[model samples]
Target: MIERSVRGEAVWIRLDRPAKMNALHLDGWRELYGELDRASEEARVAVITGTEEAFCAGDDIETLDAMESADDVSELAVELRRVLFGIEELPVPVIAAVNGLAYGGGCEIVAASDLAVAVEDATFALPETRIGAYPPYAVERMAELVGKKRSMELALTGEPIDAETALEWGLVNRVVPRSELTDAVSAFVDDVVRSPKESIRLTKRHALAGKPSTGDEDRIAGALARASLSEECRDATQTFLEGGGSEEE
Candidate 1:
């Protein structure tokens, strides 16, 4: 589940499903979209974090396995795209306070955020390829932050990168001790809110002005649908479900 709270001028959103490593299902995505909407209206800055030890493991594996067709996959992709794009289009800056592991879609969330702060022990990865699926948003947008070579390395290898490495690659702005993660994020929020809200909003708007159009969302979603419905994806997901591999979730 996604939880939201107000803290003066900032809104805090927590990914709260430790048992599944904070993996989100469709309802979670919808709730997150609603929370982002609320944040846009009510706060000058927003922060996304995780409860317990995980930032988010990714989309729930069981939910992915349950999809019976490409349309089912496409539906979930569209819903996810709404939240990811919503993060990008939000009037105020969004900060990802990554507390622990951020894998697959979770990493995508970090990429989409305006800024990110991660704990020293936090790990990030786009391991979707291991299960025969792919990270739609990460593939398309991560290069803007981390460069094409780094992004390709992540998506192609399906390997996890530590917080220090993530910072070096420009995936996150700061890396602090676990105990200091909240304070670090608070400091960033303070810095952001120090500016006039309209100035901050306009700065973000102008920064995004010449960015590539995301009209390829549908095309990307279609590719994801094909990947998710392939026999390779089904077989790999089943193997993982049957204890053939070990991961955060």
Candidate 2:
């Protein structure tokens, strides 16, 4: 289940499946794309969280481990890669609010986000190899977040990293007391919303560029409003001139 709520300029997106330890299946990835689109279109930044103690314990291994062949795993990996890449490409910044354990696919999602604020009590890992599987999605994406060597160690060993180590490895942007995660993310959201929208979008474009650091690099999308979006310009500019807060048009 994808749950949505708002706090200031942040739209909190929750993955609600605590019964399965918030483990996600292919369908969950689709739902997550929808939730992300909604939040990206409406808010300056997004906070993705899980409903229970674990942010997500990774993919639904029960679904994958019983698969017939390697092709089955590859197909699933491709689709999930599309989802994580989609999140990475969003014009607005996404902040993973990892309140508890974030393993496997959950950690991949956090890897895709621009910022991650993990609670000190939260733990993370990639245990796909332990189940006779590999983490292609995490390899392609998470390597940039925590560097190649660390990612390999975690993936191969299946040992979870505490929040402190994750913070040091740059897996999470900040580590905070579990009780203050929400408030801390909200503060960042408020700061982003008060800034120029285009600037925010453009900055993110440059940031994502760092991920696929190679030739032709001119691919930029959604960071700037097209000339055709005049109505958007009107409203945004009007909001700006009106002091962007309580004042009316």
Candidate 3:
């Protein structure tokens, strides 16, 4: 589900599960974490992208259904959070090249990255609440990026915002035509790499230093575990996998 390649100092990690709109399963997340860890060792920067049609759709619902208990679900959530935190803690910059639909965890990936560039038509949303789950990491970081009210609106309503709206909300650094996305991201990467590596890392560290702590990860994890065990969420997830209902419904 991940395709890795190296060009110059950049390690590109592509999510390649087009059959599932690039949604990640548990194995996929583990693979991604391993890839990112390797990138931190060997590369000066990492760029994550999706296949031609999607950046990512989100977590694989089928895998979620396979979890036998809330602890199983908690383990999954904690591991995913660890991977995201790994990306954030990487000494080098991690850029997200969002090409298409970035929903749920997909959106969270962009939010977690140091920088992001998106295609004009790409859509972003945090739709976990629609399935009776909440993205705890997203809830923790999004408010700092987009302010509390906007974050609340996005999380509570589970509505998608377009690329323009995403930019306005500070979710993406740049939005370009689909054909120009590669060039745009490349230019951005070029600009980032031109600066002194240590200075850039220090700058990133300082910029992220003010991110507030909520002390709610464990609480949110428990809630997600509980939600996963809910009959409503189970039914909603099955329906979602079957392509039966909108998040709003």
Candidate 4:
């Protein structure tokens, strides 16, 4: 469901599944993690949005329900850890253009994003409890974005929050009309693209300067939350060469 396009140094990654409301399948999760990693290292900025109507309605409940594999839950959880983390671990900023409903996993993705712009009518929720599963990923990310109490309310209640409420609760960076979402995100990404690559990369590293220590070893993979940065690190070295090497810095 990922459609990729590059506008200058900013890459636009869109979730192209309006009919299924962008419900994420396992393949979608892997692809998203892989491509977002590519954009984070190769492009100056990464902007993701939904196609046509919805940013996402979260997981494809139907497909998930039909699956009968014995190890499905474990396998899904493993991939989910990577997918949610792909957004969080990007050294360059990852922006979410929440044009519509960001339910369940969609909300989790938004919570993991570095910055987010939601449309006026956008809604967010974690309704997994209503469906019989726990939103362990969404809960952790949402609690980090908002707070534990509020996130608990949303998670436990399975109620959707409007864009204004989400913004007030600090779930979203800004809210604009649906008409303005595309242009607004584009303009902002353009500004980001104009910035020096290292400035953007350094900004991300500085923001994530210190990793939060989680006592649970199984639940949290602090040190291995992300793999070693081979591409972005190499790209930085090339940028040094493009200038006067050590003399320029």
Per-model CA lDDT versus the true structure: 0.88, 0.71, 0.83, 0.72
Error of 3 at 23 (Å): 0.5
Indicate whether candidate 1 or candidate 2 has the larger TM-score: 1
Best by the lDDT measure: 1
Error of 2 at 69 (Å): 6.4
CA lDDT, candidate 4, residue 222: 27
Q: What is the lDDT of residue 62 in candidate 4?
A: 53
Q: Backbone clashes in each candidate structure, one number apiece?
A: 0, 0, 0, 0
Model 1 quality (TM-score): 0.96
Query: In lDDT terms, how accurate is model 2?
Result: 0.71
Model 3 TM: 0.93
Evaluated against the true structure, the overall lDDT of model 3 is 0.83
Candidate 2 C-alpha lDDT tens digits along 22-69: 877768877888788888888888889998677877677555433444
On lDDT, the stronger of 2 and 3 is 3
| lDDT of candidate 1 over 108-141, digit per residue (tens) | 9999999999999999999899888888888778
lDDT for each residue of candidate 4 in 139-190, tens digit (9 for 90 to 100): 5566767889999999898888999999999988889998899787877777
**Candidate with better lDDT, 1 vs 4:** 1
Please, what is the TM-score per model? Answer: 0.96, 0.79, 0.93, 0.81
